[model samples]
Target: MCLYFLDCWLRTERYYELDDGDLALFESKREAFLKKYEKEIKAYRTERLIGSGTLRDYNFSSLPENILKNLDSYPPFNGYVYQNGILCARIKIEDKYFYLPPIYDEDCR
Candidate 1:
């Protein structure tokens, strides 16, 4: 199974920072992760992006405290980089689930 790193953006609290180490970690294993989860990621991302409309998706609780230390707010932000495109993870103040990106212009109805 491909391990996907979920960068969570909390709505009530800030909890993490995307730094060089994190970037390096993802970069190091990006190829392997992509090779294993390429198809799955692509398919899932397609649906999520469409479902979100114009809102961004996010995960609030998936972030570690260490990463959140740098933030000044309650909720945080997250990110996802796949073979298809870069996705930004966003969360609302009272929301639980992350809102995925909206569909591309061409994909809109």
Candidate 2:
């Protein structure tokens, strides 16, 4: 059972590959990405809380102080890293890791 579970886990797709230098570029623009998606992040969290019956109010302003603080610190995506021999940015949600697209500067294009 352990081996089967390990095999399934190993076979699961996790990382999204980035081009050379893309990881650094993504890191540099991380703040911008977070800011751009701030509304979406809040909506996602609100939906989660509502689904779990943890939040009775729909207004983001009404969220508990601790949850708000945690949301501020967490910022949806955790960080960028190399995993399974691939370079990618990791967005952690509910303990699951998902891919984050690179953020490019308009002038750099």
Best by TM-score: 2
C-alpha lDDT of all candidate models, in order? 0.39, 0.36
Question: Judged by lDDT, which candidate is best?
Answer: 1
Q: lDDT (0-100) at residue 89 of candidate 2?
A: 52
**Which stretches of candidate 2 lie above 4 Å from their native place?**
1-71, 75-86
lDDT of 1 at 15: 19
Q: TM-score each candidate.
A: 0.20, 0.24
**Regions of candidate 1 where Cα sits further than 4 Å from its true position:** 1-56, 73-80, 83-109
lDDT of 2 by residue, 1-109 (tens): 0001122334311222344454565578877645643433333321112111111111233334655566643335455555444333555546655543333223323
| Per-residue accuracy of model 1 over 46-86 as CA lDDT, tens digit each | 33232321232333335456544653564533343332343
Model 2 TM-score, 2 decimals: 0.24
Assess the local accuracy of residue 58 in candidate 2 as a C-alpha lDDT between 0 and 100: 19
